[model samples]
Target: MSDDGQDLAEAQRAHWQSAYGDHPGMYGRQPSAPAVHAAAVFRAAGVRDVLELGAGHGRDTLYFAREGFTVQATDFSATGLKQLRAGARQQGVAGRVTTVVHDVRAPLPLPDASVDAVFAHMLLCMALSTEEIHAAVGEVRRVLRSGGIFVYTVRHTGDAHYGAGIPHGDDIFEHGGFAVHFFGRAMVDALADGWRLDEVQPFEEGDLPRRLWRVTQTLPRERA
Candidate 1:
């Protein structure tokens, strides 16, 4: 990576570290609405092993573990993962969950065709550049098994804070010490190349009513 790229990566990582350090369980205890909906989708698809990106504080990771799915939960924040691990132990599902500190901007450490499902909540809209997002999606496509599912959520252009703060990139804005790359319908469509897009629906959550797009995609048995 270039110096500029490295600098951006460091800044993003430092921001998350500070954010998680300040509030260990920042997103709260309950799983987000997208996660709740995703659980049912996984159940219907008979998913077994799940790889969750940005498993912040393990709220949703715990839900999947409790549902009898073996999960590999990953996040960049060690402090947040510590809280997640404690929660997993308390839920009596420590054996079913594994935690790893991973930065999504880099290539994922997981193996190809190893997981039946990949779940990411509010991860795609981070400070990643367009190239990085494409790289991350390529990683997801590689790690997914035949017909494996990928589900992710991100803040969309329709959000109240879409352009509320300092402009960073296309739709990216810096607010509250964090840089967020908000998505639009066109951006979502561009990311759906290798996989069969199941859905891309808009929804809102949180006390501030954060606008988001819940995307579901499935890998086909054969690739081109």
Candidate 2:
């Protein structure tokens, strides 16, 4: 990472820590629509375990646990994970959930082919450069079992805020202390290169009505 990138990452981390500290359960308790959709897909595929990146206070993570999939949720903010664990206990699903403080820029802290499914809601668009995004996806691929499902969402170039914020180059922009890297369609396609791309569906969320793409892909089963 360049000095500027490192600086941005540190600043983002501090910002998230402060944000979660000030507003616990900031994203509300309901599972995101993408999470609900991913749950159904995971069920149909017989997934037993899920790894969620950027789980942010565990709204969707708790929902996945209630649906009976054992979940491992990761986020960069320890404060956010604290809230997630508390929610898990309150929901009586503590046994089904685990929390880790993880930054997606690093290799996932798991053995290869360890998880049956992975979900990341709008995590790929967060202040990450295109190379880092690809590396993060590579880590996802390495940790997923063959035929495992990967469901992720990203704010796209079509979003209203795409170019509205202060530009940090490489498509990253900062607004209200939050930095986002709006993705282009070609970048999404490139990231799915070795995976079996299943779907890329458009969706909107939040009051800003953030435009996003929910991408679902699967690893190919190894040949006998």
Candidate 3:
């Protein structure tokens, strides 16, 4: 939204703002493969309520809606969320999708133990600091109902672009006017600290051969 925050997230926010401005619908009108795969997983798990972070352009948001999932989709970029809402309305799934302007670096604007599942794509691998990442994961755990699922993808350290640009921070590199924080096994492990790790698999995307880790986990049905 407003480019007024004094933090690393501000820089990231500005970068995406410019990108979305210059190239609205940059990724086009298609849900990612991970979204399709996640939908299948949700089906088997009987997940109905979902919260999606960084739902850029409503691609995955609309996908989940089409698959009969009720979703609360959030993104920091007004342009992106605006595009998302438009897409949702165009697909006649506006009633199933709720859009919110939110930055995941801060606390989630949701009640505790509310959502049945949380989905995010490439949101965790942005230029977030470790503390921000930890905070985001903590908030996810807090907002998830017992036995809630969390599914996300992050740029992996094995990616082709991992060490190609200016070193900004821990596991982060600035390349092509964008900053990315790449993940290792340990990083993903830490994020699954409070949840049971269900699956972790490697995948690649785009022509850059961007290596990624698709993660799935669940909070125990009965918390101690």
Judge candidate 3 at residue 62 and give its lDDT.
94
Q: For residues 1-224, write the lDDT of model 1, one tens digit per residue.
A: 56765776788888888888888878787888888899899999989999999997899999899989999998898888999999999989999999999999878998888999999998989888878888999999999989999999999888888888878666778888777899988889999987799999888888788899999999888756
Q: Which residue pairs collide, candidate 1?
A: none
Write the candidate numbers in order of decreasing lDDT: 2, 3, 1
lDDT over C-alpha atoms for residue 179 of model 3: 86
- For model 2, name the residue pairs that clash: none
Q: Tens digit of lDDT per residue, candidate 2, span 4-88?
A: 9999999999999999999999999999999999999999999999999999999999999999999999999999999999999
Model 3 lDDT at residue 167: 84
**Candidate 3 structure quality by residue, lDDT tens digits, 1-224:** 22322455677789898898899889988899889999998889889988999998888999999999999999999999999999989999998999999989778999999998999999999887777788999999999998889999999888988988878767888899788989989999999987899999898889977889999999989848
Computed on alpha carbons, the lDDT of every model, listed in order, comes to 0.88, 0.96, 0.89
- Judging by lDDT against the true structure, name the best candidate: 2
Which runs of model 1 end up more than 4 angstroms from their true locations?
1-5
lDDT value for candidate 1? 0.88
The TM-score values for the models, in the order shown, are 0.95, 0.99, 0.95
RMSD (Å) per prediction: 1.7, 0.5, 2.6
TM-score top scorer: 2
99, model 1: CA deviation in Å? Answer: 1.1
Error (Å) of candidate 1 at residue 89 is 0.7
